[model samples]
Target: MKNTVCLIAAASFLCSCGGITERPIGVIYTNAADPIAATASGGSRTGTAEATSYLGLVAVGDSSIEAAKKNGGITSVSSVDTHRKNILGVVTTYTTTVKGN
Candidate 1:
């Protein structure tokens, strides 16, 4: 019984080490456009979207563009920034931010 308990404890510790973490991967742009032209026409705005899941893989949607469009008068989206975070391979969160005119 003691050996079994020790084995279980070690396994648990190893599993705990296989957890998710968060980092800013990079910036992704759908298209190439003049920076000044992109922000000049309709003014500046930002849209953010986040998704979270527990005990499962969560797929987050890119709602930044839709969010910006909701504000009205958004001519174009300049950039999309994404961040990912996970907890012990059980929970995860994804945040997407869009900036544009």
Candidate 2:
């Protein structure tokens, strides 16, 4: 019975270690133009569209960051908008993992 309990506790601890954790590395903001200009043979017309901006919270394990640096720099980024209220516009939390060469 004691042996079984110890084995169960060890398994539980190992499982917990793989659980998700948040670690903020950096933040980024992006501004993009909407309603691209249209051109015709007669002339061209440009219409101003409302500017959209976003804030991203980048996070990754410390080991992942070190591995990524070896490749060069950040190659790809994936983000999702939660539309949370914060000092930054349209606050969003992001989870990212790095890929190394």
Query: Which candidate leads the pack in lDDT?
Result: 1
Q: Write the per-residue lDDT of candidate 2 for residues 1-101, one digit (tens) a residue.
A: 99999999887654523343332211233222122122232212111111122433443232233343333353332211111122333553222223222
Best by TM-score: 1
Report the alpha-carbon TM-score of model 2 versus the true structure.
0.19
Q: What is the C-alpha lDDT of each candidate?
A: 0.52, 0.31
Model 1: what TM-score? 0.45
- The local lDDT score (0 to 100) that residue 92 gets in candidate 1 is 65
Tell me which residue pairs clash in candidate 2. none
The alpha-carbon deviation from the true structure for residue 50 of candidate 1, after best TM-score superposition, in angstroms, is 0.9
How many clashing pairs per prediction, in order? 0, 0
10 residues in a row with least lDDT, candidate 2: 43-52
TM-score of each: 0.45, 0.19
Worst 10 residues of 1 by lDDT: 25-34
lDDT of prediction 1: 0.52
